[model samples]
Target: MKKLFTLTILFFSLVAAAQTEDATSSEINENATFQRWAIDVGAGVHKPTRPFVDGYVSTPDLWQADLGVRYMFTRSFGVGLEFGYNNIQSDADASVTFESDYYRVGLEGIVNLGDFVNLKSASSRFGILGHGGIGVGFLTSNARTLTDATDHHLNFTAGIAPQYRVTKNIAVFTDLTIIGTTRNHYGWDGAVLGTEVRGFEGLMINASVGLTFYLGEGTDPADFAQDPIEAKVDAIAAQMEKMAIENADDDQDGVPNYLDRDNTTESGVRVDSKGRAIDMNKNGIPDDMESSLNARYASQSDVQTAINSANAANQNQIKQLINEGYVNVYFRFNSTKPTTYSLGAINTIVQYMKDHPSATATLTGFADEIGSPEYNKSLSERRAKMVSDVLAAAGIDASRLTQNGDGEDASVDKNSTDARQLVRRVTFKVN
Candidate 1:
């Protein structure tokens, strides 16, 4: 009863800690509030501290195995109790025969150090933990010499042990304890040191192992969550976030140090508003479905060709988004205007926006080297404004635009020559 009470107190301490969310992941997600249980079976050896209990009256400390169960009230907290038996042995000379046995039951609190904050997914996830708890045990044994002339007694153990959890379902631990047993007596075998000897009584120390299993039914976290479908969804969301950051400007050319030939390009795809394609009519199936379809129709192609091209583009675009993002649209050097060659790119991006209409677009501008801090600032702003203009013209809802400019402020590299050129681009984002 004392063991149970002490364990309960420790258990409550961990319970308080669990009230907080997976703090970091709390904003990410959470699993359902549920209860779980686990069972473990293992073996261990027990050794007593004192060599003499009452002359030769001692018990053999033999190995034993037992089973235990754990109950998790939350993903981060739980409690467990286990019971087992140990055979106490005496010296081989039979100075004392301790054929009897003693059983122990202990209560320990379990702390889940970590767990999947994503509760929406189904999977056998893991968590780390450390626990400390107090336990009480009862020990009884008999010493037989030439007869079953035995004596037995019960005792209590009080101690606090610290454990490191290996995972949500398993743990390797050690217990530090001081076992308090009732005093007993035994007759001396003979004179040991000119005077008769009896038994020695005191507290004993014992170490043990522990393991736990999560009884929750489902797929593993890796296999279930963060899969292809979830990845796509998250990609879309990330893509939207990117657009919101980019659409703050629409010029598509809201970038400096470079020029792209297209206007009213996709939200996150940075195209130059000034640099028209020398190929003038240069065209390719936009890496996006909407783009491909629009490009096909612009060429006055067959409707069937447009559909096929769009389908192909959509597949490829999705692949890229999953691997990179909806549109890994980065600007080239010396470019501040959308090049005509970017029509296809614009088409691809616009289609994504159309598909996810609720998303907002954001635009951020950057400048490459070659301009003073103040000059780069204005240049970047011009670039971003150009992008905003084109996006607004592209039929995107004006209200969804989140245009902004950082100028040369957010340069990627200040020392490198090409840094300014690369930084001269405007980024488009949707969120």
Candidate 2:
């Protein structure tokens, strides 16, 4: 009995060492929450194969019960301690009839097979568990003639349990197990085993139905936890989706957000590779648009006649064009740089300031409703300052020029590109 106990201790020590190694090597989610403790109870039938006296054989009996507690180190592996009881009886027709009571206690290693095996059904409510262990067992005779006879042995147990989850905290399971014993002196019929038939020669099979109750505050049990690798894949997919959105070209201006200095460039408007409007001549209008505007105005004889005239009416007409915003300087979306063709409008202001030295002008800037009102207000101020700088550089006195930002002009349909373009401008008021 001492030797058997020593061997059992050594076996359990080895199992603990192996379990520690497996736990350290496995990948686990440190942040995930799950139930790790459970209680198992079962009732079963057992069949024992044993050494019986002549004409004496025991029949299979449905008198076995088991109770156990388990703790999972991870989703896939765990350990358990269990106690079991079994009753064996001889057939009534046997020449020599006997009865025995068997009891055992074991410490076992458990594996969640559904988690270890890469099955498609692993995510389903059905699962499988495999367990094995070394333990001690005692068998005592129930006959009056052999009241002092008992069999003491070391036991080895192995089993598989197929289970179905009925709820988050409960599951139903069926187990099939084989128990093997060694170094038993007495047989089931209360007879001593022959000296030659000494080592490990006892076997019993058990089939049981049971329930497992999980105990923890978490809603997910360790058996049903998500795979760490699958969770990482999901995280990576979400990051890729965010990257796709950040890199998208919202304005369809042929440039991604990171590289686009001007995000709201008008469609069909010629732009450089960087997505800024192209103004090769350094004028207030884009080169592609300057030609068309020049052609349209060149055929207008009345407009030309007014510009060449020096009379009060022609001067008033030009001033009215500037003040009324017809001759205003246009800008690209979200830019302080005036369009190349609109440079002529600044020259018109400069000429008027020169002709009437006593006159002053106020340059009020306006922006399209593309951005926040506060941001557009600041942008409008910068646009007015830019136009004021141009006039100062063109010899208009700083004292005679007043710059103001009217902020966003929301009168037009904000969804219309043409209307938005028509509003990003700086108009003059001659004082």
Candidate 3:
């Protein structure tokens, strides 16, 4: 009895140690909630082997019962305290007849084979566990002739259980276990095994079916806990998929499909970041050219006076507007094509060149400070070339148009989208 009490203390101590070790590990996800405690109960048949009276083998009987409480430190590893009872009797046809009652208390280290092998990916409701432990057992004779004779021994037990989850809190399981004992003072039929019989004097095999009841705050049990690494990988995969959807450009415009209002803009047509064609005015011409024409001829009387004065002052004014960045052609983010609102600026430059047949124009392109210096430099060159192409298409001689890339404009705050849009432009220098 004293040994039994001591073993009980050792059992709880080992359980505590296992839990402490698991708590300190970095792999454990502290925020994950699941049931970590469970109660196990079972009953079945037991057969005792060896160390029995000659011709007195134990009979098979439904006389074995066990109960245990388990704590899972992780999904894969745990510890349990179990108590078992068995009623052993010799076969009626045997040479000798006897009946004995057996009892044991053990501490088991449990490994969840299903979780250890990542079987959850294949099946969530099926699982298996392997367990082994050592404990103390007491065997006492129930035979009338040797009622006072008893056996005290140290026992070892190992078992495998296959379980099926029936609900969130309950599961059904079947277990097969072998128990071996040493230091037996008495045999199965009440015969005394003297001190000479020392090592592994007795053995018993048991098969049982039982139910496990999970206890905790959440519906998920620790047995079905997800692997932390697997969970992280799933989260990253979801984020990447979302980014792919958000960045898709079905119209091949500079704008992403998610923000594009017009997904089927014709090729080479100028558009805004929202993928809308940039024709702010109802007039057939783009708004940029309309605005330049409106600014150039705001006063009809002054224009007529300049025309009567040989149009020199009027040409100088137009030249000043083009050179001072007032009539600049603006583009959308990362696009070489001028915006629909800025198309009028190209027409203004074209008109100025046609009016002064001997004049030549320089188109210097610039980008916002968003990308690498080298990429921005390339983008700016493309913007200048695109504007020069439009000018050549409009009957302006290509030889009269010189394109230059000024790279990124660092004057404005890079974080401001409106300010950055103002700088992604092509400016004119008409001679």
**Which candidate number maximizes TM-score?**
3
Writing each residue's lDDT as its tens digit, candidate 2 over 282-325 gives 65455555554454333123433555563455577777766766
TM-score of each: 0.38, 0.53, 0.57
lDDT of 3 by residue, 124-227 (tens): 89889877788898888777344345577788777899988899899999999888787777776667755536776678889999999999765578777666
- How many collisions per candidate? 80, 8, 3
| Worst window of 10 by summed lDDT in candidate 1 | 187-196
Q: Model 1's lDDT to the true fold?
A: 0.48
RMSD of 2: 11.6
Preferred candidate (lDDT higher): 1 or 2: 2
C-alpha lDDT score of every prediction, in listed order: 0.48, 0.76, 0.77
Candidate ranking (TM-score, best to worst) = 3, 2, 1
lDDT of 3 at 389: 97
lDDT for each residue of candidate 1 in 1-431, tens digit (9 for 90 to 100): 34533545766677556555345445444343232566755555555654244444344244655566766545556666766566656567764455545566766566654333443343334333444444444344454342324433234443333334355445454443444344333222211122222332423454556554446653222112233346558889999887776554434436422333454333343343453322323343233323433431233233235435656776443323422322322344435675444444355545656667886767677766555778777767777677667766888777876767676644255664333333445556666
- In candidate 2, clashing pairs total 8
lDDT of 2 at 402: 93
